[model samples]
Structure formats: C-alpha cells, structure tokens
Target: MKMKKKSATLLTTGMALTLALAGCGNGSNNNNAASSAPASGSASAPASSQAASTGNGGSAVEITFWNMFGGGEGDFVDQIIKGFNDSQKEVVVKQLRLESNEYYAKLGTALSSGKGPDVAVAHVDRISPFVKAKQIVPVDDLASKVGLDLSQITASNLQSVTYDGKPYAVPLDTHFHMFYYNKDLLKKADLLNEDGTPKLGEMTPEGFEKTLAQIQSKVPDIQALAVNTPYFQEPFLNLYYEAGGDILNADMTKAAINNDKALSVLKFYMDVYKNKYADLNDKNPWDSFSNGKAAFWFGGVWEAGVLLGDASKNIGAMPLPPIFGSQTHWASSHLLVVPSYVSAEKQEASAKFMKYFSEVGGSTWGKAGHVPANANVTASDEYKSLPYRDQFIEAQKTVKFAPQTDKYTTIVTTIAESLQNIIFGSESPEDGLKDMEKQINEVLDN
Candidate 1:
C-alpha cells in the first residue's frame, strides 16, 4: 500500500513493463485503472450461437469465476468465492486469476472455442459482443427462479449490463471520481468551520482556485492539483453532459465531439492544465496527491488502496464539484457478470450466490478502494463506518456510464489518445475534439 512517487526514471521503467503487458490487454496492473464501455443505446442483430440446450440439468453445477484483479483485490475475490462454496450445498464456484493483460482477447478466444469460464468478469461494453453472439443466457428468468430481483441494482448500472433487454451481470461497485482534499492543509489554511470539518460543498472551481492560490503562497512546494488525462475524462464528460453535450447520437452512429457544449468542456479542462491549476505532466497523479503536494484531484477508488495505512492520514475525499449542472460526480462500476459460455446450470447457481458474493466481497472490496453497490453490504455497519462513505455514496448514485458497445474498448483508445494530445499542449481543444469526432465516427462506421 505504500505507493512510491513514480519518478521519471521509475515511470519510464513501469511504462515499458506495463506497455509490454498491454499487448497481452492491461493498461495498468492497478485494478482501479484496469477497466469499462457502453451499450450503443440501440439494438444489434440476433446472435449466431445457439441458446437453450435441451437436456437434464448436470449433477455438477460448479461455476468458474475468472477475475483480473490481483494482490489484495484478488485475495478478496478468492475469499468471497470460498465463502460462497463453503456456505452453499449445491453450487461450487471456481475462482481463477488470469495473469495476462489480454483479458478480453483471451476471453473472446475461450468463449468462441467453448472454453470460457462460467462466470467471467467483463466490462459493460465488453459484454456487447458476447451478448450479441448469444453465448450468454438472459438472466430475467434466472433471477426470477432464484428470487433475486434486478430492481435492486442501480438502473444505469443494470442497463449497462443488459443487452437488447436482459440482465447479464450485477454491477458490484461504482468507481466514481471524488475530490480528495488534505484535511490538515484545510485546517492550516483556516478553511475549517468551528466544528472543525472542512466545508467542501462550498468549494467551487473558482473558490477552490482561490484556495489553491493561498496554498501555493503558504506551501510553495505543493501543487494545486495533479492532472491525470484519463482521470479527468469522466469529469469532463460530466461537465459536458451538464453543459449539454451528448457523447454520441441516440443511435450511436455519430460522435458528439464537435458539439459546442463538448468543445466547451474540453476547453475548460485543457485550461485547467494550461493555467497551472494542476500539474499535468506527472505520469501518476496520486504521487502528487500522496506526497502532500496536490491540493485536490479527481481520483478513483484505487487511490485509496495505494494510500492504505499511513498514506491515508493526509487524504480524504468529497464528491466531484458541479461546474455546469445540478449533478456533481462521475463514476464507473465493476460489475459481477456471467459469460456467454457459462453453462445454464452455473447461471442458475450464480444467481443464488450473487447477493452473498456481493456481501462477503463488499467490505474487502470497499477497503480496496471502491464503493460497493451491493444493497446488503452498502447497508451494513462496516460500509457506513467509513469516513468518506456518506459523501462518496451520494456521488456514486449520479455517476455517468459510457455508451455500451462491443467496440467500446477499441473506440476508447482513440478518445484517450485525442485527450492526451489536447491536455499535453499538442493540440487545441477544437482541434482535439475534431480529431475525436473523426476517430469516433471511424469506429462507428466499422
């Protein structure tokens, strides 16, 4: 949990190592950065794979659960699987860690070859291809037979996992972005109330900018914020949506990058970097965040994990501040999903264990830095007990999700690269957005 400040040299090494692994599908070994995509908001053609195998139910209803998270996260998933298997009389869950970065590629190969796990972890957009292929079964009936209602899950998260019309997975946690402020620094700056808690909701972009000016004057070594290009993407999208920018047309046939509202959001974000409100050049924002230098940053839950123990002393989070709308946060979820290749017997078993897996996995998953969406766990004493829970949970409720498509992963890189160029002084917001629209349309056309 002791995250070292990734120096230029260390970053070079890590990037070289991780980029090599990227060919194998991982962008980062860090789970918070590991994964996501959206449904096109339109229907695709029927699947090619046959559904409803007619036969007696298999005697062995062992379900295989494939996970990409390792280290503490992997251990936590294992514990959940162990608990489910030990507590249940009929279903057995087999949990496996696929070390390769090529998670989806390998998964695609496996499912097509009829060798994929019964319950493999796939992101929202990632499930589109599988769902269209009809490799996975619909869970409307599965949930009914087991008495687990899909209504319990957040509507957006549920919709992301649902293809044409059926639930394919249960979203586990919402990884929304929140603003982490240094409590000690806030107190030092006399921003705290008589009650001693820092007044965060009042900290608007302008108000926070003034605070940063004071922090800069007093703590010369600290940065106002550390800008991670990708971390800022969702917040920018949130701002775009608030400012009236749609990411794509309702049909998902055209990109909305050229819209005035989207361009406005992009310009505002680039201005943050250009105006010296944040240090944009750092390869890792958390380093600037953890070292007592960054005043505020929009970071994911994994930021909490790497800052476990002593590192947590200086950092605390508030919901993302609203720049353009009533909505004030941006988030994505880690969903618990079933694969197309999973046996019907295993799907039946998985349904029975969904809530339980969510409960047992909740505390640990949260401790690993995500906010659990499991109704049981979120209501539990442990979740309410966390310091940032109240604020973060509210933020999670309004988190935004990408348009889901089988091609989401492939499409994201174009947007990511375009964003990097705009943030790093390589392109203008207008130019960058133009590039984004072009690249996005190219993907849609394909």
Candidate 2:
C-alpha cells in the first residue's frame, strides 16, 4: 500500500506550464507530452461522437480515464472498472495509470493541450488552480444528467470541490491521519485499557507528553512515538490545525502562520525530539511503527489494510486526541473531474463512472483504507464491518482541508521545505516562522 511520493520538481515545472498555457486560453493542442498506455481491461476503441447513444443497440460511448493509483489502491480501481464495464453497455471507460510523481504535470499538459484522458483524478488541494483556470468543467449538471444524487455525497467532501457555488468535481474519498497504537506494546507498558485502547492521562499536550515519557520509562528500547519526519508536513499540520492555526489570512491575501499557535506546535515537536519521545532521525517512521519498534504512530487511514487487517500486529486505531484544542486535523481527498475540453457526451459518461465509483465501488475503495466520500457507502453494514472504520469516519468529520486558493501548491511546498529546516535545527523556530511567513506572503502576492 505504498503511495507515490510528491515530486517537487514536477510540481514546479509542470504546474507552471499548466498555468501558463491556461492563461493563453483553452482548446490549444501545442504541447507534445507523450500519452500513456491504457490500463488492462479498458477499451481501446476510438471515442464516439457527442451525438452517439447507448440506447437501442447504439455504440457504447468510449471515454478515457486517468488516475495515479498503484499497489492495493490500483487493484481496487481495476475491480471498480471491471464492475462498471460488466454491469452495463452504455459506456466504456478506458483507463491510463500514470506514475503519481509525474501525474499532475502530465495532467496539466493534457488539459492545456485539449488532449488526454477525458476524465482524471485530482487532489482537493490541487484542483483550485484547475478550476480557476477553467481547465476542468463543473460536474453538478453532468452528475444530474447521469442520475447521480449529489446530495448523497458527504457534505464536507462535497463542499471541498465546490468553487464559485458550483461543484467542479465528484469527491471519492477523504484520506487523513489517524492515531495508531501498538496494543501489545501498550499492554507491556501498562498503558493499554481494558477494552484494548490506549489509556492516556489527559487531553492536553503536556498530558500527552507525560504519557510518552511514561512509555519511555516502561519501554525504553522502542520509540514512544514515531513522528513522520520525512514528510514532516502531515504531523505538523495535524497539530497546528488542532491548535486552530490557519495557513493564510481571512481573505487569503497574505500569510497567517506566524502566530503563537504555530509556534507552540513547532515547540511541541522540538520537545518530543529533545526528550527522546520520538526519534528525530527515524527516516522510515511508518515502517518503524509497522515493525513493532514504535509504541504509537500518527498514520494515514490508507495504511489500515496493512496495519489493522493483520491481527498479529496488535494495532488499535482511534481518532487523534484533542491535545491542542479540538479534533481538527489536516485532510485531503481524491476527486473525479472532467476536463472542460471533454465533449458533453463524454462528460455525461464520466459522471456515470463517477456515480458508480461513488456508489457501487465505494465499498471496495473503502477496503483500500480511505473513508469513502459517499455517505451511503459508509453507512452500509458492509462498510461498518471493516476494522476501525468508525474511527476513520469520526476523524474525517473535523478534517481541515487546504485553503481554496490557487497559490496553495506553492504555499504548501514552501511550508514543507521550511519546516524541515526548522525541525533539523538549521534555523530557530522563531526565525523559521518569520522566514516562512515572508515566503508565503510572497507567493500570495504573486
């Protein structure tokens, strides 16, 4: 269940090209990026005209789909595609599985050039630029045409894709970090409760640290907590969001991360490292937790398949504690979008695929460890039966999605790079905050 790492180089050069070409206007085919091969089991037939119909023995409308899913998630997608194809004859969805690191760049190029997959996957945070550039079409009318009930989608997930009072995409799943504890290690440290949950002293940050200290005292050999230092942004955002911090000002006109809340969160991580509560140098912290070398971890819900499915691991997951203030934490979603350049018929077909993905395929997607955006799927008895799904649902309720600014990609990347320097002592927290604020404000201004 390894997800692809975000490539900074691709994001910078690729998205820059996307925005530049978008500024030149749509329906251009000047870019020459190579197209990827279709996934196994997808149709290879040429796309049908907009007037084509699937009724009365008409040709099935062929539409190209693009996504970055791999490993276990990829398997689930393959199953979903097969189910959709077998269950009907109205539409045929051909898929192109792109390398995640290069996905956005290639997608940007495709959209700008008016050539590529008719439908594609976009992160909630990454779509702001696309929507602003009009590279993707609004899906509300298309969903309605396909008999997809938009009201059945999770409210928060739906809200995330809405721009200018219109839904630009159909959200598929909300993915975020959850609190995972090694039950066997907790039991050995006398921190496991009677019902197999961790027993904490209090809900405050200090109280949480004291618990970590106690774990160190009882089981000094293992890391009390495994902080994700490689992708430091997730852990940092989880706590900063809990502290009610914002990345931008009210109108999104400037930076807003230099306040006390952020400083306190950064200091908290510094203390965790200083006290040896977590190893600052554990590069593969997720593996450390998975291999039973860490007592606790803040891991993504997507990892549930490997961590929770195996009873031998003795893992128990719960919503992150309200240590800073509230349950709010960082979250992002995978959404289905139709490029604005797609034909109306293909847009309708894409909506049907989205409906199936949200309705019928959601349970299978849930098995891949994401909280399905379709409320009906989450409410199903089958979905409720999965391990720790209740906790996953609860955690999603308070998720703080990235701000809806076109500058988000640049801003977040800046934050990630600066935070790493701060955590590694390359700069003091105070100086780092000042520098990060300046950097973000510059991005916003541009």
Candidate 3:
C-alpha cells in the first residue's frame, strides 16, 4: 500500500502537478525489513567492472541520489548504495532520503533551480511533465556508455519510460495488487481448496459476493473482505481496470471514466459495504487483514514481506481473479532517472549505478516485494525462489499503467476524492460520476 497524502487544492497542470507527482512516494513505510531481506550469501557480483573515474587522476565521481523510500524499501536501497560504492570504487553514490509527503515539492523546486540530485527516483506515471519541462534527460545513450543493456529490461517496463522513442529512465519494478486470503478463515468457511488455495467460485461480482456471504454466515465475527477504503483509488482502479475502463479516451484529450464499466464497479463495491461483506468503517483495513480479522484482501505486491512472511498466518496469495472480464489491473513502476541539470559525467555515473541496481541489486530489491523489471533478474532462479513471485509476475503481465498525460496527478486526486464521496453517500454514484467527469474535463481543459 503506497500511502499518499493528497492536497486539498488540486494542481492542474504545468510544473506544479509534475512536481507533486514526482514527490509522491509509492508504498508504505511501515513494512518490516526483516521479512524482506534476501537469503544469506545470495548477493550477485558487481554489475560492471568498468571504472567511473574522473579524468582528474582517477578520482571517484561522486553523485547524489534522491528517493522517497522508507522502512524496508529504504533498507534495501541502503544496501544497494553500499554495494554500488564498494563494487569498483570508481563512483561514490550518496543518497538523500526524503519524507514522501514533501518529496515532490522539494524535487520540483530543485529541478527548477537546476540544483538537486544527480540521480533520482521517479514513478513512471509522474515523469511526463518532467519530460515536457525538460527537467530529466533521456538515458539510452548514457546507459550504453556504461555498458547497461536496455534491451535486457522487460519491454512493457521499458516502454513506460520511453517517450519520443527514447528511454528516459531505468524501470526498477512493477508493483500491483494480489488477492490475499487467510487459509484458516477460508477453511472455516469451507471455501479452502484441497490445494491450500481459496475455492473462489464463479468469477463474477455477484458470485464473489456469495462467497463473502458464506464466510459471513459461517465465520460471523470476521470481515469477509477487507476493502481498502482509506486508499480507495487502488481497489477502485484494480476492478475498474479489470472491467476494461480507462481514465481517458484513446487520444488522452478528455475524461473517460463516466461509463457503465466504472459505474458497475462502483455499485459493486457499494453493495459490498451495504451487505456487510466488508466493513466500510474499518479505518485500518490493512492491519485488520494482517491481524487475521479479515478473510480476504486485495493487497499490494509490496506487502509480500508482511503478509507472506509468517508461516503461522496461513496466508495464500494469487493474481486478482478476472471477475470483471480480464485480469488487467492498476500498476505503477519505480524508475531511476537523471535530471537534465546533471553533468554528462554524473549522468554516466548515474547510468552505472542504475545498471548495477537493475542487474546486481534486482534480486535484493525483489525481496522488498516488487516484481523486478529486469528480464534477466526475473528469469534468475533467485527471484523465482521468492514466495508468490510467479503470481506477481503473472499479475504484472496484464497491468494497465496510468495514461500519459501531464495532468494525471490532478485528475487522479479528483477521482480519489469523488469516489470517496460517492461511497460515503455524500453524493449518489450517478451524481458523483457526473461531477467527477466534469471536474476532470475542467482540469484537462486548463
């Protein structure tokens, strides 16, 4: 669960929205690192033996890296930095870990001022405006300079960061939702399969509800499904995407969320809340699921450490069922990018660091619960050894990334707020959908 604090006022376009989106950190900082660490003695060798020495008497090139990773993710990043620093001693990488809430604002200001980190982490969805504003530079040539083969990356992951036929960033991983179920609770409800999986019957909204109703009837005290009402956008996007809904039309010129597919998904969730299939008021729904008070959860791959770590928890994970039609679901990627303001030498150094992060550090990163974007890493036996990685990979295959629009941050924030109002009864679903469409159009027009 990537916890983002939305602003009260929407940032419509230009540099403001881009900066806000850039700072938006993905995933929760509450995850425990202990559960996500790689097995002992499994670290791979250095990604490159080539030196990143400055022309000045073989001095190491020093570069600053910026990111919003915290808790377990932050720990993994720290390890990667150490590994890169120790690998060849040609480049020294220093990191500045910022609080996610304030990250984009500062990054925006720094980029505008041409004085910030040489290397930084940006979400794929958030970099469009930066590209427009020329705050970040393309990485294809730089990657080649450092012997980093961009072709080794997953094609979709590579494509997400490409604009105008040039790659801007090195994608780290694809993060998305997984259906997690409590085996004990499912067994009590007679919904557990003989294979230790949930016997999810009939993959329709109504059929899924029937399964929930059974759990409610048999195991009366627990929440049958733990809906993420707090971060409602995630669960909303997951199912809406499955239903073949798009946030914008093909041209990316207008709002496209006010259709039957969107409405159906909204109503389905409303019904879930109304029927007590899930507790709408459970403020800490993630905690509820982790504490065994909920039978099912549409949790993130980033949660693998917490949800799948304990053998006693009896948790099982799989790709989200294709209830609405297809397995397509919402996903985002973490990308390593170089600011346009960075020197050519630093950009090359950044490229080296990015290559190592993708090639050598990828396995360690996968332990932090994201599906590594490196094709080689995913094919490696080490990545396959992780729990539920195959499911993560499968889910990653059909993910629908955010539309390539500069106004996406504003549009999505509006959707999040509007969906909340609709679900909480302040506005009817029909009215809310109309208002949301109008609001998005206004932003797009601006």
Q: Which RMSD values do the candidates have, in order?
A: 13.1, 11.2, 13.1
What range of 10 consecutive residues in model 3 has the weakest lDDT sum?
A: 36-45
- lDDT tens readout by residue for model 3, 141-170: 998899999999999999898899999899
Higher-TM-score candidate of 1 and 2: 2
The lDDT, on a scale of 0 to 1, for candidate 3 is 0.87
Whole-structure CA lDDT of model 2: 0.90
lDDT digits (tens) for residues 362-401 of candidate 2: 9999999999999999999999999989989989999989
* Cα lDDT tens digits for candidate 1, 116-156: 56666666657778777877667778778887666766676
Model 1 backbone overlap count: 11
Using TM-score, give the best candidate's number.
2
Q: Is candidate 1 or candidate 3 better by lDDT?
A: 3
Ranking by lDDT: 2, 3, 1
Ranking by TM-score: 2, 3, 1
- Please list the residue runs of candidate 2 whose C-alpha ends up more than 4 Å from where it truly belongs after superposition: 1-58
